[model samples]
Target: MANVSYFEAWGMWFDGRSTPGNDLLGLSMIWWGRFGKILSFVAGAAVIVDLLGPSRLSRYSDRLTGFLARRTFMATAGASFVAAITFLWITDPIGMHRLLQSVLCLTFVTAAGLLVTAVSRALPATHRVIRAASRERVVG
Candidate 1:
């Protein structure tokens, strides 16, 4: 087995071939590599959410944001595992693999965007306030 980065793992998965070997909970290289890609997105999203402000969907507590993030992440992880295994085992591996990969990539991008929005909301808005302070100091 060659050392592959997370991005390279996606290449291995979508190369229109499945390799032999199990690195992820007994899943073969194809499924494992795909799983790695999904899991990385899920984990990275969770971390970003954890570092961000409270969710608008919840009021008065950060716990709600954390809870929802955990639930959503777990749900994605579970669904990805089931879908990957189902497609790899019971259906056409190549077609299903591509489909699942696309779905996961879409989900990852959406989650990252949401995380960015949340964190941006927590950032201190300095443009107007700083400009006003500078004007006052200059005038005085």
Candidate 2:
């Protein structure tokens, strides 16, 4: 059994391996975990503020909420598709390979495209929030 150590800062466990790939994977996991936590907190706070505060925190003028929701759905669907394919391949690789040759591969490509588009849409919101917060910090 491999020994695992937990890192408080990263909020993750890591095996005692010094390999480059392991280090990179650990770092990426940490980054994603932190990013997700921060984003969730920010989004939750925004909702609370919008509900309770006299003035709205930030309002999107361009139907961005719908666009983001749609993009999020696409990304989620794409991820689910890929997950199902992975499970199918694990259960029956030969059958999965044959199916992939027919249509699964194309579907995988489409899912990847959706993921890319979703990522593109997601980044701007993060940047916009960061900019707004910085301005508020400076002004207030």
Clashes of each: 0, 0
Best by lDDT: 2
How far residue 87's Cα lies from its native spot in candidate 1, in Å, is 20
lDDT of 2 by residue, 35-108 (tens): 87999999999888657533233344124545655677666666767755775566465655666554655566
Cα error, residue 135 of model 1, in Å, equals: 39
Following a full C-alpha superposition, what root-mean-square deviation does model 1 have from the true structure?
Answer: 15.8
| TM-scores for the candidates | 0.25, 0.31
Residues 28-92 of candidate 1: C-alpha lDDT, one tens digit per residue:
56776588799999999888756652332123234434554556555445555555555445444
Candidate 1 residue pairs in clash (backbone atoms < 3 Å): none
Q: Which stretches of candidate 1 lie over 4 Å from their true place?
A: 1-26, 55-140
- Candidate 1 local distance difference test against the native: 0.54
